[model samples]
Target: MRFYTLFFSLFIFSCSEVVKEESFGDVTTQQPSIIPAIQVYASNTDTDVKNGILYYKDTPYSGVYIVKFKNDRIKSKSQYLKGIKEGCTNKWYADGKKFEQRYYSNGHKVGVHTGWWNSGAKKFSYHFNDLGQYQGSLTEWYNNGQVFREFNYVNGRENGAQKAWKANGNIKANYEVVNGERYGLIGLKKCFTVKKGQDKVTR
Candidate 1:
């Protein structure tokens, strides 16, 4: 399990100038292809095991990859260099619905990232800069396709009015965050305000 999780620690950087921070914990170093002749995994075939590890192959990588499930279903795919995910990474649900679509460069998430419900409806969409810090606007929707939450971020920290809507489309909550401080209604009411302390926020 630890080894499996290692591949995913792939995203880490400060909200501000994340790309400048680089280094995140123990990075996964690319292992040179030692068994190039080994057949890559095929969805229609049995699971391929190598050295007690699950199926993995180096199929003329050329800086791109498309992963698959044992059933021949596409699982996830991405482009990367030196073990760092670059360009676009895409994944799908077992049912064939897109689950996640994101962009990255040099291991730091950049551009837009989107997710969808199993039913194929957009679930959430957000933007991040080349540094991997949340920027611009972010929004999420209920499974029913109703707006769930809307907010703005700056350097990964909430920096503007944030609003949430109930499934009925009614405003549920509202607030504003500045430099990590929260201010506005404690609940959905239009009145009342509070100020919370500050702390670093991340995606």
Candidate 2:
């Protein structure tokens, strides 16, 4: 009788252990699975310039638009609202380095726009107004980190001094614009002819 009792207890304990393991497995299986975020591609979208909007399968798009390189890396991403670019836009090089960044509002560029060379050096910097016209200083740099060009703009036209330099730091073009006229020298021999609306130099 003691042997039978011992056997019965051992069977009950083994069954309880199996029940606990099965209960743990059931909980793990009932847990939710992770889901990835969705991405929209520009190529899959259609532009409607006349309506001033973008469409995806005939529906107005109001999310982030993405452009990717052939290698599946993100090339550019821009925010859109009601089919128009309405926020920050960023671009990246194939090697994953940032190439450019700019802001837009109501489909027009606003604020600062900047670009960088593949070598991680600043390439250019520009500013724009709400009207999408150039405003403030515009500067460009060579890949070797030398200043290449500098100009001031007011209302989309160059106003004030404009300067350009060679990669070796020598002056290439030095001029000034006042009231829609250019003055000073370009290169070594070319002279600027001041015309009513002309801003370029003639040899």
Candidate 3:
């Protein structure tokens, strides 16, 4: 099962120049990708900077970046030390079960994010915009892989009317909501089926 989560952070640089501060702990350097306009913003051991700030300008990267370490066996990983989540960050439980996994964007939580519950019986997933809004394909599922509920948004709020399905493969009902209020041609019955999927299983 896959779960999604969203997280954000604010990084305020004090001056015009970026400082490279080597993070303390046992960090294993993974392969760095060929970043386009090569700009060595900062390093872990720099006198002028108090922290490391890695930046990007349009090129793509492929690899893991081990930045901070809690112990010799594990490390805190991130895709963008400066900004942009190029990879994934994962955490493990004491029982050897994967506890969490979060993707990043410029170190901010942006895009399709998923996670698990403590009971391990349910799964959760959500979407986010760059500035912090649930913006895109958002969905949830039961432990057995059945969809609990699935939806999305443009800026925020349902972009269109909410549509439900019936087992015979038809539109069960459609509701148009505005300003969190339901109104106008308030409801419609199942009469059509545009395409097919699990949504069509009974509809």
Candidate 4:
């Protein structure tokens, strides 16, 4: 009788331990670490983060994808975005010149996209439509960094003149745009004679 009682007690304790472990596993499996709103992935791949990389999958049965950078610049950092060639995409230099864009539901480019510098200068800016057409003002800049002027676009064609200036503040350009075509005169700002023995006015 004594032996049987001792055996029963041991069995009960063993069952309790098993139950505790099962419950722990269930809780850990069902609940993941929560991420804040407006922030993208907080936990990726379930693998430990190391060497400035975090990986995740677009779906349970999808190919693994990754986000990589020099260090913890995750917000400014960009990735393949959702394991598709689509979604908010950004490309950048290590020194931080970047081209960033977003796409529509059908994977067509959309909205105001930009190329920028870490110094916050706008290198170029373009607006696009759902069909990936350039449908807005497209601006470019001089190397010394002035507005080289902008041309209005429609269906990826230039529909207006691009007026711009030189680094010396003189109007040095007049460009007509049509379907990425640039034609017409480039203002060289030359001095011209209006009358004899009179000083030349540069135009």
lDDT of each: 0.64, 0.74, 0.46, 0.50
Q: Which residue pairs show backbone clashes in model 4?
A: 157-179, 158-179
The list of candidate 3 runs beyond 4 A from truth reads 1-76, 79-87, 117-122, 144-146, 161-180, 183-203
Q: Residue by residue across 58-104, what tens digits does model 1's lDDT show?
A: 32222445567666777776655544555667788876667888877
Candidate 3 structure quality by residue, lDDT tens digits, 1-203: 12222221122223323433322122222333322222222233321222334333332332334433343344344444434444456554444344456655565666666665555644667787875577866666555655554555776667555554433434444455667676433333365344534333222
lDDT of 2 by residue, 1-203 (tens): 99999999999877555521111101221211111123478667364434767776676677667888988888988767667876667899998888998878788999999999999899999999999999999999999999998999999999999988778776777788999999885554545333323445554
- In model 1, what are the clashing residue pairs, if there are any? 43-72
Per-model TM values vs. the true structure = 0.61, 0.70, 0.40, 0.48
Query: What is the clash tally of candidate 4?
Result: 2
How far residue 147's Cα lies from its native spot in candidate 4, in Å, is: 0.7
RMSD of each: 15.1, 17.0, 16.0, 15.3
TM-score ranking from best candidate downward: 2, 1, 4, 3
Model 3 RMSD vs true structure: 16.0
For residue 2, what is the lDDT in candidate 1? 88
Weakest 10 consecutive residues, lDDT, candidate 1? 20-29
Once fitted onto the true fold, the runs of candidate 4 whose alpha carbons sit more than 4 angstroms away are: 1-66, 75-83, 91-105, 142-145, 176-203
Output the number of the lDDT-best candidate: 2
Evaluate residue 60 in candidate 4 and report its C-alpha lDDT on the 0 to 100 scale. 21
